[model samples]
Target: MNTKGHCCPKYVILQAVYFKLRFTLSYRDVEEIMKIRGVIVDHATIQRWVYKFMPFIEAEMKNRKARVGKSWRMDETYIKVKGIWCYLYRAVDKSGNTVDFLLTRKRQRMSAQSFLIKAIINNYRPRVINIDKSGSNTAAIKVYNRRSFSKIKIRVLSHL
Candidate 1:
């Protein structure tokens, strides 16, 4: 594949993408790091590289089959994006393998239901789902169980 671009080498572009993703660094931070390595590049260029390479990376990742466990731990947390608060729902298996994640604007039952549905569909049905004592999550699980034939056990943890 043509990894090299007109202005930067493939290694430099991949380094910027790796820095931006593997760490919580901004595009400007990645640019600064590349500059420290004597590679002059703009933050916008780095952003473009990330946007361009992400789809290919995701496709490569999806090609690999994941061996996730049957017991899953689900939770939701608030994240700020562009100064706006959003909810991030995440699920991990018993071995701490990432099952799935969904970002949404609302923290209601519908949001929880959608997140669970997506997780289940993507990672396959789990035997047991552990969650916090959230009423929305509980209600969403109930709704999911009612609609789906494969019933999953829900375990509410007092502290997550």
Candidate 2:
């Protein structure tokens, strides 16, 4: 294909980058497949494309859908970053796709509420929230539910 007038290399590269993200494929694998199709590209080039186009993709996707849907599930995991404890709360929608995430220093009621509020700001507030029996989660829900705010939140707790 010759682009004598409209090359649109940005569009072409964005398409390739989106393909990589959709499948979560490794860079080397993408490079090899593109090479097999006679498209000369490098894994480094793919990485560059990903870094360059991520903001645009995020903006567009956020514009299209800005809600976590009705049924959302949340879980927390602890990780040590540089020997400092970090708590990560990840929420997923009904279909199992991730909706929101939060990293905090404390695993208290405030942290849980912050994560929930962050998720609500980005996505629509969930009607049903499934969380563990952590006191933080329970407390956050109780506070939000009894609040006089415009959007009172209700959360359902479950554990293993």
Candidate 3:
């Protein structure tokens, strides 16, 4: 959250970043918002701030997030993002709290594996994982287990 060389105050930059991320507004919309608040900033500057500070923001949010359950349910689905088709991989604890999510351009074992790694890193490793009958998911879990040498029980649900 360092604003070392920034021309505006930290709060102003944060407000612009929050508005852009917390809503569906475009960069120009955030620029207009700053203008309404008497801050003369450009949309491109807001975009730069988001790109610069997003990682730090994500790390802070992850640290503040509640611990997930030991049991998890993993799934993936095809979704349209920015008019492009992509696969969204997600995991939720048994109590229905989200663990983590990732959007990938393809539905494959590598994508699933990367999402699993990210989820495990952000949250504790689950004791059990229930997944739909997707061979890619199964393969990813197997690879993870083999590499980590940790026994994480996997249950394949026939019906998604």
Best by lDDT: 3
lDDT of each: 0.87, 0.75, 0.93
Query: Ranking under lDDT, best-scoring first?
Result: 3, 1, 2
Error of 2 at 131 (Å): 1.4
What is candidate 1's lDDT per residue for 16-79, written digit by digit as tens? 8889988979999998999999999999989988999977766766768587999999999999
Ranking by TM-score: 3, 1, 2
For residues 25-115, write the lDDT of model 2, one tens digit per residue. Answer: 8988888877876778888888877886788888888899745568887778899989999998888988887898998988888998888
Deviation in Å, model 1, residue 24 alpha carbon: 3.3
The TM-score between candidate 1 and the true structure equals 0.63
Q: Write the per-residue lDDT of candidate 3 for residues 10-116, one digit (tens) a residue.
A: 99988998899999799999999999999999899999999998888888887899999999999999999999999999999989999999999999899999999
- Give candidate 3's whole-model lDDT: 0.93
Q: List the RMSD of every prediction in angstroms.
A: 4.5, 5.8, 2.7
Local distance difference test, candidate 2: 0.75
Off by over 4 Å in 2: 1-58, 65-67, 148-160
Q: How many clashes show up in model 3?
A: 0
